[model samples]
Target: MCYYLKLKYFTLHGPLPGMPPQFLLGNLAQSGLLFDKASLPEAHIAFKQRYGDIYQFWISSTRLIVVNNLNDIQHIFTHRNIYDQGDIYVQKFSIVIPHGLISSKGAKYKRHAGLTLPLFRRGKIVSNFDLIVDCVDKLLIRWRTKSPQHVHLDIVQQSQNLLLAIFGLIGFDYDMETLDNDNDTNKNELTKALQYFLSNFNIMLFSPKILSTIYFKLSSQYRQSQKTIEQYFDRMIKQELDNGKELIAQRKRTSLIASLVGSLQQDEEMETNKSEEDRKGLSRNELLDEMRLFLLAGFETTSTALAWFIHLMSKHPQVQQNIKTELSNNNSQGLLSLDRLDSLVYLDCVIKEVFRFCPPINGTVRTLTVDDRLPETGAQLFRGDQILIPFHSLARDTRYWSIDPELFYPERFLGADKDHHPYALIPFGGGHRQCIGQDLARFELKVIAARLMQYVTFGDGGNQVNSGGHLSKLTIIPKHVGVTIDFDK
Candidate 1:
């Protein structure tokens, strides 16, 4: 038909080159994304080599232009209105969390962000230092009981629990107590619901929207999990609303739910004190969606990062020693204060290198609002076209780094690559729409990493198990992270 010919020829025009997409599969068959030969990050690098920085690729019926060049990436990220959150990202997240900040845009996004953003400000998150350290201590205690010969074959699971516990306590003042659970078998209803959401989110993401909707409708297990999550969050929100005003007046430490509750209280008071239209804040449903978004984003990305950090430290013993050396030099013993944690400059580099070497999320997507041209590559873009800004490609691109980009050297942050390009190593991404909880994530990683260094050392459990590679999930996690946890004298 004429439509097929138009899609084949017209879609590939405008100086952009791409592998010819097969009838329905598009480039999915050729891109190695379907098969497990290479992870998405590796495939991104490979595709860049073949098609240059700006190349069109098809994921089934949808068209995506992979922009590997930093100049173009910077432009896209900086101009927020022109390059909004991608349709794919929005469509996928909106299925479950339409009112949540992640799936919203324009005025709705701004309204939600205005109230919630302050809760995650550096000052507020830093004050939760004690709670974060307490969670880390619980993990340290659990790890101390393990025999020296017992290879810590579950770093991923341990990290997930630690983060989930921390997020629960900090965000909602509700203790997940995941650290206390022996295994996932003992997880509570809320925990099970959360697990169900995370475990099956990728499935929904990859499926066609209509098909995913059908699946959601038909699956009793899915409906039950959603209902459980909604009830639990609703209960918590109500509890906070009932008791939160006094806490707000007392000027207590801010938990996310508490802050939202306080904001909602003010909105209620405004309705009474002023005209109906003068009141502002998120509705109950909006608050629930936000909480769900917080839970998913808070634990998922950071937990994967922690797992990768442990895997890397296990392989590089010298790097572990260097961290300990940094801690010792600063006299960072016992429970560390924010000031003491801040003084570990080398530890900062190691975290940066881990993120650069293997970012948790492979890439972020943005969609064009209007037709535009790339500043560096001169590639033409059309309205509604989606562009993939790969974090892995940008970090590993040789053009941006003074030293070899391939090496997993943490020292790169201190030496030749100290002044690397701004967009070259965006683990949390860049610009206005970047990960809002970045500061919280960084703080959690630093506190946990510093405490682990102070108490224990991770040793390589041999190549058979600890061989480095990644498993692409909501976040790209280490597929094989077997490390031996040794208690310090």
Candidate 2:
């Protein structure tokens, strides 16, 4: 029956323009095999060779159109109404993240985005700069202790800790200080939850929710850990509410949640002048869900990006040294102030290059709300078509980037020539729905990378980090990224 269904689906679509579709399973098996172990860039290049620039593939009954060109990405993102985040992965993300920006869509997403945008404004991000620097300082101190030895540092753990500290300051006004105090329960629990989420990516993909529920019931530790995260947030929210009146009166610290609660309180006060429906604010459950989304979204992507940056730097010694030299000239004290870090041009290039090289979110899946045709290829796509824009592939495409696309060249982003195709390097994405925390992420990466370079020199640890393969998860991550950090001076 399954075989017959596969044949029927492929037979209906006779190679819709760019490339021919396979008789059975379409190009799904081939695409899956390429992505199974190779990096996103390699997979994209391989597919482009076999199935033109844009190709269609089917995984069982689901059909996907992979787009590797900048023009195509612009078309999809700009025509926001036409393309929405529609994928099985997004559905799964909703299960864990609830109604956060990453999972939410349409008017609901827009409204929430409106309410939350102010919290991540430049002024607000600048206010949180000190907290970011403090986190980086703590990380450097740890690296200093392991001086002169090849420290088998888990880049992933370090990145997670850094982001946790940043998010704690911004979200709950809590200083995690996980880097300094390894035994912090709040830090440990959050870390465990994230790690567990990543580790069980495949299970979440294949296992049905009912089966997952049964498995969670059987696994006492998973149940306990999940409960810990829920209880922690619940207590934190309650405590904030309890202190809400006093907090508003004093206006001591500025947190995203505080900003939100403050805004809602003001709306309530002005309720008499507004319509009944307009006066309604986010419910307690809604607030908690939003908080969960902010925490996970803010931390995971930034941490993952940093891990890749460190791994890449270790591979390219010349680029690492250039960053080190640039840092020395700017901040001789090795203290990374946000202002000083911003002045390091070479360091900024390195971060941008790393992002371009290995985008944390490799590709985003969008579904066409209405029928549309590509301007360049004139390929017609119907409503409900799933489009995969491989950001990793576009960044490295030889057609776009004239240099050896595979090589890690920070100079590609340096002065004068900084204006490459805008859509070409879309690590944070493009259009209205670009990453809200991009500036914050950039700040965190700059400070962390600069401070680390100041204190240590990362050397190749015999084996290359396996930063590829098919992880049944939201983000593309390194399978087992091992690095050796050597302390300097």
lDDT of each: 0.82, 0.69
Q: Report the C-alpha lDDT of model 2 over 353-432, residue by residue, as the tens digit.
A: 88887888866678888899987777788887888777887877777876776877889776433788888888877776
Q: Residue 434 in candidate 2 has what lDDT?
A: 76
User: Which candidate leads in TM-score?
Assistant: 1
By summed lDDT, the worst window of 10 consecutive residues in model 2 runs over 465-474
106: Cα error in model 1, Å:
0.6
Q: Lowest lDDT 10-mer window, candidate 1?
A: 263-272
TM-score per candidate, chains pooled: 0.92, 0.84
Q: Please, what are the lDDT tens digits per residue for candidate 1 over residues 140-159? A: 88877889878878788789
Instruction: State in Å the error of residue 297, model 1.
Output: 0.3
